[model samples]
Target: MPGYEAKAAQLAKMGADLIRPSGAPPFMLLGYAEERELIAGWAKKYGVQMFTSGQNHVRALRTLGIKKFVGATYFPERMNRVFARYFADAGFQVLALEGIDAPFAEVPKVPPEKILAFMKETAAKHKDAEGIYMLGSAWKTVEIIDRLEKETGLTVVHAGPARTWETQLRLGLRHPIQGYGRLLAEMPG
Candidate 1:
C-alpha cells in the first residue's frame, strides 16, 4: 500500500492524470482496494487516470521482451502458489522459484552459478526464449549481468537495469556504457 501511494504520487508529480475525469492518460494501475483508493485520490487531484493495479508481474515480460523469470522466495512454502497463479494469469510459464540469500549487496559467487543454471534450464525448456529476468531490488545483479550475458550469450535483465534504460528511453539521450557485462550502460530503450 505504501508503495502504491508513493508510485501514485510520483505519477501525479510527473504530470500524469490520476483521476482521468475526461481524457485518457498514459497508463492505469489496478490493484488492492485500499491502495487503489489512495492512488485514485492522488490521480484525481493531479488529473491522472485511476484504476486497479494488476497483480501479474508478467506484464513486465511483454514490456521487456523477456521470458522465463526466476523469483526468489526465501523460506516460504505457500508463496509459489500465489506466484504461479499470478504468472499463469499473465501468460508466463514459471521457470523457477527458489530460495536465495537476500540483500545481496556484495556479489555472491555461489548464487550466480545457481541463477545461471536456472536460466539455462528455462532456456532449454522454452526454445524460443530470449533471456532471463531476475527480480528483487535488493539483489546485487548489476555486478553479474555482463559476465552472465557474455558467458551464456544471452541478455541478463535485472530490476536496476531499467533506470539507465529509462533515462535513454524517456529523454532520448545516449551515453557510453562500460564495465558491466554485455549490457550497454545506456541502452536506447
Candidate 2:
C-alpha cells in the first residue's frame, strides 16, 4: 500500500476496461481517497460515473450537515493522515483522525465489537465532532453503525454502507434500509 494512489488508479482503469465491453458505464467504489481525481478523469473520458468511498462519505456528511467530524479507520497511521487530508481538502473540518493500525489483510478480521469500541472511544474524545466518519469497507463496521450513533449521539458514516447508499441513489433506488445507519435508513435515497 506504499504507492496506493497509482496502484488504485491502475486497478480502476483495468476495471473500467472490463466493464467497457458490456457497454455499461463503469461504476466503482474505489476505497482510497487519493485516487479519486485520477480515476474520475479517466472515467470521464469514457463518460463513466466513478464513485469512490471517500467521495460517498463526504457526500453523506454534507447531506447530513456534518461540517466537523472525527475520522476512524481500520488502517495504519499514515493512511489515517491521508484520509484526514482528504476530508480537509473536501472542505470539512476534521476534528480528529486515528486508525487501528491494522494491516490490510487484518481489516476484514476485525470484530464488530472492536470497531464499535474504537468509534465510541473516538467520539467520546472528540465531543465537538458533529459526526464520526468510519473509513474502510472490508470490515464489519456496518453492523455497529446504528448502535454507535445511538450510543455516541453522533451521526455515523461508514465507508461500505455509504458507498452502497450513494450507488443505490445514483441507480434511482429510493428505498430506505434499516440498521446499517441513518444515511441508508433515513436518507431519501
Candidate 3:
C-alpha cells in the first residue's frame, strides 16, 4: 500500500475517470463502510465518483440478493474470520469461510487455478450459499468470473467486477461485457 498513493496520484493527474482503491482487509474489517468516503473524497478532487471494493462488494451482494455467502480470502484464517464477522455485521449470512495465510503482498502469487478451485470447491460444498466471495483485490479473479459462475451456479463476486459494475452504473454507461458475471452483463450500466 506504500506505493498506492503514488499510483493514485499519477492516475488523478492524468484526469482519469474514477478510482477503486482496495487491497487491505484491514481497510474493510473495521467499520467497512467507511472506505467509500475515504476514496470518494479523493475522487471529488478529480471530479469523478468512487467506490471502494469493500463497499462495492456490499452493494453487489444487495443487488444480487445474496443473503448467504461463502466467503474466502487470501489472508490467514484469523483475518478471514474477521472478514466473515464484518460481513455478518453488514447483514450478510456467511455459510462457510476458508482462507490461506498468505501476506497481502504475496496474494497475487497465488495461482488462478488455486483461486478458482477454492471458489468452486467452497460453492460445491456449501450449496446453500447464494454467492461466493473471493476477497482481496490483489487476488486475480476477473478472468475467471464467468467460468466460476457457470461451473458452480453461484454468483461469483470479486473486487474487480463489483467496482466495474458500480462504476458503469454511476457513470451512466450501459455497455455490457461478457465473462464477468451478471454484474457486468446486466448491472443496468
Ten residues in a row with the worst lDDT in model 3?
29-38
Which residue runs of candidate 2 sit more than 4 Å off their true CA positions? 1-37
Q: For candidate 2, what is the TM-score?
A: 0.78
Worst 10 residues of 1 by lDDT: 20-29
Query: What are the clash counts of all predictions, listed in order?
Result: 17, 0, 1
The numbered model that scores best in lDDT is 3
lDDT of candidate model 2 versus the reference: 0.69
lDDT of 1 by residue, 78-98 (tens): 544454445555566566555
Name the lDDT of candidate 1: 0.49
Ranking of all candidate structures by their TM-score, best first: 3, 2, 1
Model 3 pairs in collision: 173-189
lDDT of 2 by residue, 1-189 (tens): 235335445655666432111100112122334455555665665454555555677789999889999877665666666667777777899988887867878888888898888888878888799998877667777778889989988888887677767777776677788998788898643
* TM-score against native, each model: 0.55, 0.78, 0.78
- As for TM-score, the candidate ahead, 1 or 2, is 2
- Off-target runs (Cα >4 Å) in candidate 3 are 1-19, 33-49, 101-103
Q: What is the C-alpha lDDT profile of model 3 across 1-189, one tens digit per residue?
A: 436556677777887777666654546755555655566666765665556667778888989988999978877787777777778878999898788556778888888878888788878888788988878778777888898888888887788878778888877787788878878888752
Per-residue error (Å), model 3, residue 101: 4.5
